[model samples]
Target: MTPQEWVTSGDDQAGDIPSPVGFRILIKPYRLPKFSAGGIALVGESKQYADIAKVAGQVLKMGSECYRGERFSAPWCKIGDYVIFPKHAGQTIEVKRNDGQDPDQYLLVNDDEIRAVVKDPSQIKAYL
Candidate 1:
């Protein structure tokens, strides 16, 4: 499903997700398309690499201490906002679903690690 669809679907495994703590933010990374524009299916290894390299995701939850210091006059992003961060910057958390589908992946990143907030996550293409 697209990032927008996934966020709005209300099917996210919220019960299984861990809340962020102390300046950390929980983000649900955007899933890469399984097929390429040329109708070629990506190999398993390629897909995995691309998944790890994905830099854009929707903000799920934030720590109590996030964006609370004098380091900024205002918050750079907020919950439900799509954001970009460094590749492989955060701790990856994978949640297995009961339906036997691929597990959902999330990133727990520092609030300072976010680079920018994206208005449209679908427009951000995977580089891999």
Candidate 2:
């Protein structure tokens, strides 16, 4: 499906939701505290990670000027790229999800706030 169709389709299968505009990019942060280095499951440590971890997120959508903007003038990342950002980098917004908890949280960050892109997000170390 086309990007426009994906955005408007209202299907919450973990891919295709909202589209960002201008210099904003939508990122879905990776789940934190799933397990510890010592092989202990951090079942309820999500809150701790959310409070004090620089997050790695998969890029969902890129704004029109993300690659060629008047502000930054060069693109360092693209859609589907994994990115690292500060713990307080972007504005957090929740979107509806298939899971019946609170809406899934997504970060809306400017192109400049993206620190680095990763080939494999799982390889990045998660802090406790």
Candidate 3:
């Protein structure tokens, strides 16, 4: 099924995130690394540094108008794709889950903000 269809589907729905309406993208940022390359645990300031270091994320959804502009062409990224965007390019949104646990954080970014696409985010050394 297409990303849009899957999201709007009714089967066992946990809840829906804010659907990107225009040239927008919904992404779930990869969690920061818990330990450094040396295997030492990162604390307070270190953890904060790790968090801000990430510019990669998983594409959760996209707006219908994404890449469809009068001057632009087509979109390069799709749902489920790993994309690299500018640091601090998107807005943070808290999503309330149906399981009643803590809300998850998501980024709402414009399609134009995406800089590059990676097949596997895990392959990124910084993230690993």
Candidate 4:
């Protein structure tokens, strides 16, 4: 919910993070590789992320793409992060850290609504 919606609801504080559901997520480690800098690695096996065509864009998921329609956006999800989507109503999905054997999909990490994973403080602060 947006800030205004959250406040009008009055059920809880806006600062209290809601659950994450139906969100295209980005999975990543709380602490990323300062060494790797820019590279794609599998989810879990490494902290590296998959740098894709729209990796650094502001909008995590634009809802439509020229080639890949409704593609899952946001590759920076992590444990305890809240996610939301139309598919999942009334409940949100919280991103949890998983161990992936492959490094290539590290950038693929996971899917959620948020721009980046809650694991990345940088990404979280931006939303705040």
Candidate 5:
């Protein structure tokens, strides 16, 4: 999905999301587009791996102690920023929706795990 669509379509209802603790950050990983640039439909395996190997995500929440340590003079990122992280860096969490739609996936990574912030998440090309 495009960055704008990702933000607008997010499940942000109250009491649905978990607040991060310590120096962790809550991130909602970007879902792979259903079709490639050439309009070829992606297979289920490809979509599943997108969730497993998430590289770009929007910062949803921050722990109380994030960026407060000596290592950081200031916060590297904040909520609403799109960030890049290692494919296998964080713990993956899935939240089931009450409407019985597919559960949403999120990544819980340490604040220091963020490598860079992106101006647009859709421009990121993640390889399988």
Candidate 6:
């Protein structure tokens, strides 16, 4: 959908939802968390992996809505969230493949999404 269409569609319930352009924890089924009912990263996610995943940024990119849709590379982002690139850049981008979460092609993310995760952009070998 065109950005204008997306923005105008909100005309009906604009007051009910806040504009999502900044940093905020995403709600389950992910809408930005707001009020007590809406929360960051859904209330159900366990804290168990929070630490291990922290060493590497962990941002959730929306899984493809359809098989033909182009997967967003660093599409929507949260500060510490990992960005996905279509191709790997060796040491510059540490890619650990996770098995398919769904029947679609798999979702692969760069390790850079972790909280406080930062490396010199120059250090990234080269986008491959």
CA lDDT of each prediction against the hidden true structure: 0.82, 0.70, 0.74, 0.28, 0.83, 0.27
How much RMSD separates candidate 2 from the native structure? 6.4
Clashes of 6: 9
* Rank ordering of all candidates by lDDT, starting from the highest: 5, 1, 3, 2, 4, 6
lDDT by residue (tens digit), candidate 1, 28-123: 888667787688898899888877667899999999999887897899899999999888679999877666677777899999999998887767
Question: Across residues 54-81, which tens digit of lDDT does each residue of candidate 6 receive?
Answer: 2222232322331122554543445333
Q: What stretches of model 3 exceed 4 Å from their correct place?
A: 1-15, 33-40, 123-128
Which candidate comes out best when scored by TM-score?
A: 5
The per-candidate count of clashes, in order, stands at 0, 0, 0, 33, 0, 9
Question: On residues 1-128, what C-alpha lDDT tens digit does candidate 3 reach at each position?
Answer: 23333233332434567888888899877655556658888889878766677777789889898988675766779998888888779899987767776666779999889988986554443442
Q: Which pairs clash inside model 5?
A: none
For every model shown, what is its TM-score relative to the native structure?
Answer: 0.82, 0.70, 0.73, 0.16, 0.86, 0.16
Worst 10 residues of 2 by lDDT: 1-10
TM-score between candidate 2 and the true structure: 0.70
Q: Which one wins on lDDT?
A: 5
Better of 1 and 5 by TM-score: 5
TM-score of 5: 0.86
Per-residue lDDT, model 5, residue 30, is: 80
RMSD of each: 2.5, 6.4, 6.3, 17.3, 2.2, 18.3
Considering summed lDDT, which 10 consecutive residues are worst modelled in model 5? 6-15
lDDT of 3: 0.74
lDDT of 1 at 23: 95
